[model samples]
Target: MKKTIGRKEKPYMLPYFQMEEDSFVITTWHDGQGFNLYTSNERYKTLERLISRLPKGTIIEND
Candidate 1:
């Protein structure tokens, strides 16, 4: 799936990730919560893999 960086409904928690082209960006949410804790290269890789496995258009209700 294409990695589009943007808000996830919250503001405090920013979910940052890179797209297939390695373009990095940070996304939070409209509610303002749930930011990404992974900063290291390894952690980001792990997150990328995990998120990639999720089904397309999977909505994360929690912020």
Candidate 2:
């Protein structure tokens, strides 16, 4: 199967891997059961820090 980005309902798989910058992978569901993405907004800071360390064009997979 082809790797993909974005929610399954709106997948941008091939195009997502073609871009040079400013591309995003999105998901409609939260990681933890019963805890939405917004339930812990504070994690964004740490997450941002970690992501910033990655080289440009890096693709992160939650799984």
The residue-level lDDT of candidate 1 at 40 comes to 40
Model 2 TM: 0.25
Candidate 1 stretches with Cα past 4 Å from truth are 1-22, 35-43, 48-63
User: Candidate 2, residues 1-63: lDDT per residue as tens digits?
Assistant: 434465345434442234334433334556433221222233343656656766999776654
Q: How well does each candidate superpose onto the true structure, as a TM-score?
A: 0.25, 0.25
How much lDDT does candidate 2 score?
Answer: 0.45
lDDT of 1 at 43: 35
C-alpha positional error of residue 37 in candidate 1 after TM-score superposition, expressed in Å: 9.9
- Candidate 1 residue-wise lDDT, 1-63, digit = tens: 334477345435445555454344445646765444434444356755656666999655533
RMSD over all Cα atoms, model 2: 13.1
Candidate 1 local distance difference test against the native: 0.52
Q: Where in model 2 is the C-alpha error above 4 Å?
A: 1-45
CA lDDT of each candidate?
A: 0.52, 0.45
